[model samples]
Target: MNAVWFVRSRQINRSISWWLAITGYKTSDRSFSNRIYFVYLVIFFAIWGLTVLALVTSTVAEGLQAFDPARPVWLAAQITVVVFLAWWLWSLFEASRRSPIKFTEEDAALICATPAPRPAVAFAWLVSAWFTTGLLFWALAITLGFARAEIAVGGNPTWADAPFYLSAAGQLLLPVILLHLGMLAVVWAFGCLRLNGYHSQGSLNRYPLALGFIFTAGLVFGGFEGIFFQSMAWPASAPVLSGSGLANYLPGNLAGLAWAGLGMGALYLASRRLNLSRAAQETSLSGRLQAASILGDQKLAASIHLKQRLKSGSRPFPLPGRPGALALSWKQILQSVRAFGAGALYNWSIVFALSLAVLLAPNWGVRGVAALFWIAQLHARLTQSLRLDLDQWPLFQALPIRSSYKLLAEIAPPGVLAVLVGWAGIAIASLLAPGINLWGAALLLPLVIFDLACGAAWDVFRQARAELLLAGMAPSPSFLSLVLSGLILILFLLPFIFFNAGLEAVLVALLWGGGACYLLFSLASRSMRKLGK
Candidate 1:
């Protein structure tokens, strides 16, 4: 096969693998035939059930709602939904085409050497496109039909009475869909062009820096324009072509259609012009300097190397100081707090501040509380990996350390940070909000602390199931963790939600209840020592 044919085949094969894996039909020697068939049956039922559910829910929800002729929000919402649907369809098609498949260098060479018929390859590509595009169109038609039926039934009117509403909805959705498709085409063109440029380079060193600059500039420009745009009102003079029979709307509609056609053409031309064979050449001067510097200052080079190792989460050379085991645990806690990225100690501080904001924000208290809960959950999961550094653990074990000491070490950084930040937030809010007493602020600290402690404990519990928890690091699977965290959050918020009964009474109840639960769990831990290990 030619290069294009080979690439398409590899893409299909990879998609098949992903489909099988998702349906639990492992394509491995250990997979049983019965398990494969069972998985297929389950997937078949799942897809059927989801389709049925969507159809039923959409029908019911639509039937109860009347189409308001005067409300622009409804039209805006419909356009937004249609645009999202189009983007979702495009993303699914692209994801299927880029699935990973392992291949050797020799296999690649052999495939490149083959000379397949271009017409046949093009025919195959067309067939794949037809199926994917057809599915999207079918879905769109079903959705539109369901929406129209719902509006007609709910408003107790015939199609003839409100043909204008249907026309208006269609007019709104068409432009949105076209805009989405145009954006996708632009992105596709950019990716193709970037890949071609990278292939021309023999080395990738400068590419990273170049890409970073491009990303930073894009963010700055995009954010600036977004804020600027949102502040301005839509131009009143812009022609609003609606409800004028489909034929009357056709002129403006055709203009939009023409723009979309131009965008698609540009994308196709960009793809064809992609320079796939170009290779980057390396700079020789930088290579020579690095060799001389290493020889001339061996000591400095070693120190620099040690710093790099530490940055990569490796232990420092010559070992850590001979602190007591508890002291060593404190050091580890401090390290986790100072560490950057997702699990950094600084993020937990933010979470603490947000929690206080939630408690104090007048109208926005509920939303702030929900956001705080999410941030705390995220911090816990992000920091859970710190325990995986076995080298750091040995230093603790070598000294006189108990499991409780280890657990305390794990919990201290997040707990203390959460408390301090939470207190500051409450103090700031109390200063601004009148009628808020000292007792209420004092009560808020314990509640926040308890919630944070529980979150930390759950994270540790998840680490005990390392394999499952690690697998769940991906955002999709992490939903289960989110759900569990949400439950704990509800428990944390219940006392505050009913604080009108008296702050002292609520605090006493929470402290007693939390203390009892903690003692019970601690006692239970003695029996479940294997998990702690």
Candidate 2:
């Protein structure tokens, strides 16, 4: 146990040192680069702090306006229930598939070779995993506590006044944090059992899956009952917002915390029975996956994940018998299918959800959120096929096809899919939401197409440059290159900025999108051709 702690401490120190070195810091000497890095970080944090503070202030103000003082308990309970349900389902799914306790390849190798106690190693890894995974949640909870301070004592308070409300905020925050940790403890317990090979045998293998199915069905039925009863307005129907005093809620919260603490205690006792060798074997790929993620090489991480998934007896899609560009398209489409089952349909569903949200939004805030969600999803999905193609650039380049043809073939499947989904989402949203503007809905077709083309073009350019860096031919693209690309995109989108979503805007977008797609495709082809040379 002591040895495990020592190893973990040394690992943490090594990681910190590696990060510092990467950021141009040296323990031996102070240099100009260190100062530059220090200034950059200071400026970055200054900007980030200001932006976060403003956003939190606005969010808190909005929330407090709609907050019901009589139902604080109800709100907290609802949040707790939602978080538990999500974590429960996720834990079951992940444990059924793989071990939740992860180690780096190095750590796994060391633990497997040594006489270290399995329970202590698992506990250490569990804590490390929980902290790493829960950091974002912890941050959000802390921010909420900070924001709640404004309304803590029933007045708008400045930063100096916030301290007065710290007691109230802490009351809210402590339980929330404990609840999250408790949920993670439960998950780790289940994961340890899975890793120890307890759940691998024939009958027990399907036990988790059966439970997951039952849970899903029960959830669906309960939701239906709630909605049905609420809509019928039965006298006994539970109110959506109901609460009691904080004093009444406190006992139940304490009871829940006690239960979780007991579970954690049991987990440590049971960990001694775990199979360290099996655990290490199961998590071998996970270490590589985590290493790739830590190094900011998401593409590498994704590729590793895909390969892992394929190792479960699933083969790649067979190649098309046709030659030239058709073969490239088939390869891209197959890769997409194998990497993400029905991913195109999933993307479509997201776009539809966003579109519906936009139309049904009662305020600019909701609409803005919907738009942001769409943009984030669009950026990721639009480049899916192109990234896959770029990964195997040499194979595609060697094909007996023109560069332009190859580029067109690679982009066509995903680009067309994106435009189709976007258009369908908008059209269906218009039908479902009669209040939306007909002209705006109609004009969105071209705009969506234009957005897809622009996203693909930019992604291709960015990824192609990264490929060059990976191949040792060039350094990564500079800030200037990024600025120039943005300028070019703005120029293309300039005409639509001033016009309303009308016939004129539609015509402009259609022409611009078509021309831009052609030009960008040609540029990509030319750039890619220079790869081998």
Candidate 3:
């Protein structure tokens, strides 16, 4: 075998062994346990996959039968395209920040110092990263194909038709794989150029921004909207909307060809210009990030991510010179600015978009689910400021301010931001969805603040317990914490269910929200005092 394949195989084996060892399946003495564990995981995923497939087929059938202007298949196609484009741009943005392909310090010492071919080594790294990171996309492609196959067969078939299903999955998998491969290659090519000093990080970063701008402009003004949207939808919808033929399939076929051609071009560029020495220097960060993920150290992972963003191009936000409780709030703002800079705007934009979705949903049931999803996402963002404080517990405990003030200060900034962003979304939704009760929408602004306060309080309390036991490292939130938090938030929203849209509902919601916030705040403050001790 060539040296490239040999190195790649060894790397894969080492990763699997590391994971197995961490899970207490030591190669020296636990061979049987390892095999048993592997079999258990396989069986679990197989059963889970079958259940998901059954749900998908049934749900798609129901959605198709529904009398709605936005057909389920078309909506799915739109969402799939949007997700793919977002991921593609994100990959490029990340590549600009750090090398897409990474080599460990050992690889630097051995491979970089040796006469191993640079192109071959780059290809191996690309393949390894793609296989490991692209598993989700592969599953999504298969699921999409399965959905399409059900549509093609005109009914959901029994298990006896497994061969037909497999053939359909195979048919769609090739194009999706090719399209994914092209995206990866393009990102890898950019990383190679950046490592070779052929492109400045700042300039490379602008590539995605520029492409996004051009794409947006085209949609608004360039009159290619229908054609662009039709690319993913045409093949899926044509059978139902326009009758199936070779013409219906032409767009998808052309797209596959284009992606394949693009992959070849990008690979050629990377092969000709990749620099091994610079790649070796840059890859250590990737190794650190990967290790943190494998060990499930979220704080370490966040720190590494912050460090990478700082390196990419961070703008300095002015810090307050005052020292005390106020300093904590300033530090939160500073950390957010330094970590995300202008990119934070997109986060708020998502809040507004999700709000619009929740308000526009057809029924209270759909609206409730969307609102819950929105709250879950908001809770994650709300905890960022609290985490900043928790990460520096030693210094935080040293502050002269009382524990209650410190806790309140930590949660205040993000809670305020959430209120403002969510209120903006509500205002827009009121304008767009005329049926929305303006009074109810306005009442949500305060509820948003209290909701964040309560959620942040719980997060602080849970994190304090974790930090106390784990020493300095704050582990990711446990499943129990998430479940409890969701339940608490649901209770806070329960007033909307008990009282219809009016002053009574608004008053009850305010009382419930305030009561929950106060209770959680008291608990969290008590926990913070323990940390101080």
Tens digit of lDDT per residue, candidate 1, span 1-533?
Answer: 65666677776676566666766666563658757786777888867854564455355444425344543233433343334434534443442232111123333344323454422333334334434444454344334434544454553545464454345445545644454444444434443444343443224234434534553454356532244322321111011122112224556456446545665675566555443222011212222333435456533343344344355465453434556545655465455444444424455655755666565656756765656564555455334433433223434335455555455555556556566676776677677775666455455455445444544454445454434334332111134445554565555556666665476556755675576447534642342243423
Question: What is the per-residue lDDT of model 3 for residues 4-115, given as tens digits with 9 covering 90 to 100?
Answer: 7697788888887786676565555657777887777668777798568656755664565463334445544454555566688788888887777787777778776776
Each candidate's number of clashing pairs is 8, 0, 0
User: What RMSD, rounded to one decimal, does every model reach?
Assistant: 12.9, 8.8, 8.8
Q: How high is the CA lDDT of each candidate model?
A: 0.45, 0.59, 0.66
Can you rank all candidates by TM-score, best first? 2, 3, 1
CA lDDT, candidate 2, residue 52 = 77
Better of 1 and 2 by TM-score: 2
For model 2 the local lDDT of residue 317 reads 55
In candidate 2, stretches whose alpha carbon ends up further than 4 angstroms from where it belongs are 14-93, 133-152, 156-164, 171-183, 197-261, 286-295, 313-320, 340-387, 402-404, 411-530
lDDT of 2 by residue, 364-436 (tens): 7787677656655654565555555555555555677876676567556665776677667667777777677
Error of 2 at 149 (Å): 7.5
How far in Å is the alpha carbon of 215 misplaced in model 2?
10
Best by lDDT: 3
- Please tell me which predicted candidate would have the highest TM-score against the true structure: 2
Q: List the residue pairs that clash in candidate 3.
A: none
